[model samples]
Target: MWENLDRPPLDGRALTRALVDGPRGSWSRVDVVARTGSTNADLLAVADTAADRTALIADVQDAGRGRHSRSFTAPARSQVIVSALVKLPGVPPGSVGWLPLLTGVAVVDVLRTVAEVDAVLKWPNDVLVRGDESSGYAGGKVAGILVEVASTHPVVTAVSGVGINVSLTEAELPVPTATSLQLAGAAVIDRGTVVRAFLRAMGSALDEWRESGWDTAPIAELYRSRCDTLGRRVRVTMPGDTELVGVATDIDEHGRVVIVPESGDTSPVAVSAGDVTHLRALDA
Candidate 1:
């Protein structure tokens, strides 16, 4: 149903109207850019001035970025790059840190509903396809999320950016371990449908976050149930010269990965920023 659109760089005005026409609580505003350096970069630059719940969708990004400055590549017509602006109220500065994880939950919900694939969250923020890891297939990194905070007068704006490999083919993937919807047998997907579903899911999540005192338990529970990182051997690389190798015990209340070392000592490490690598035991 959503495939009837002509192509990328779609008319923003028309798309916005169509999305709003569907439901009353959809995105407040939708702006489509033909091309940009990065939707996150563009949105963050004006987040302070933009109205809350505004979204930016881009067809192509010349400098699209992933967590830790990793390059995110997708063919101009095969990916979805979107950034939504959220304003949080009554949430402490420390507690607002879970926005990225919350956003990832919203994304995985939409992916499961539309694609009907068992998608799992990789701790902190990454989506993985279940069962793909054990079958010698690419199991990790189907999508990535980045949330940037901009604080100004009377408000803290979170710019949530998402990169989804929608219609990308196997040959177009940046790495062998990475896959797209098409490669995962979601060939009938329509980009607009995916975007609309994502926005709706995000709106619901944000509303609940604001109402629930930023209590991350509900979202965390959902994340943990769908997360593949828990109880796995992992190596977390920090920004400085610090690294931890342990078994992921649990996701703490603050969205930190709780790790237990091989020495039989339990230490809950709060990872605000880092790369988590899931390791396989030599015998496994």
Candidate 2:
């Protein structure tokens, strides 16, 4: 376990004490495993019985998946990989789509404060940092979030998986467009600390969301303020291999990215799910 001196194992007991046992904590349970295929899949497997607010972390994820089943893998202890089981009650079905966006907002806030990195959100739920021109790269994907519905028999439950690169070096990055906290010049790189802060931030955001009756206004405003894709020209690859190139104009009430096509139509299109590629920045 200690073969890599720099990449030490996570202290599960400490995490449980700080996040699950604290007075202001909202977690129902926290589990840390040495190796897992994917924490999100593990939680979904038990979604039928897993308690709400349950958090699962894996030191090494062999088959981590991003949006569209894109493989996201890293060296052991190289990232903060976790999944939280969230059960939403009294939330309207239409408003449920905001869960992932809300999660992104919470995570971006945590990264900005805890890691001390200039973090921002991209469209649906990607956390990114401003790229350094000297580094020969535009802003890279520092973290990616995947939200999957678990069940609806009794209530609306979903498993949200968030993977944040922490200690990966430039050569270790999964892709040239991917980056880690260390590579992003984070002030702190401790996995346990980052995980604890992320949980707290997420819990608080969920509480606010519920209190607002799943209202999208409050969170939407904040998300828009931090979103970098709002005024950029983007190419969205929709289902069926179709493509739409337009300017991202707004985030609708349903949390979809509102796009104004460059031509062929004047009406705006709202995209709920798709791959978004930022083409260029437009004048605000």
- Candidate 1 lDDT over 1-284, as tens digits, reads 33425344445666687655555556778888878999999988887678788899988888998887887667675787899988886677777778888888888888888877678888888887665555555644678898888773477778999988877777878987787776776634667778877888888888887788778789888878878889998888888957778888888888888877655455666665678888887422
| Alpha-carbon RMSD of each model | 3.2, 2.1
lDDT of each candidate versus the true structure: 0.78, 0.90
Clashes of each: 0, 0
lDDT of 2: 0.90
Question: Could you tell me every candidate's TM-score relative to the true structure?
Answer: 0.90, 0.95
Best by TM-score: 2
Residue-by-residue lDDT tens digits, candidate 2, 1-284? 47888889889998888888878668999999999999999999999898889999999999999988888789999999999999998777777778889889988998999999889999888999888788665658899999999876679999999999999998999888888899888999999999999999999999988887778899889999999899989998898989898999999888999999988996999998888888855522
Superposed by TM-score, candidate 2 places the C-alpha of residue 218 at a distance from the truth, in angstroms, of 1.0
Alpha-carbon RMSD, candidate 1 = 3.2
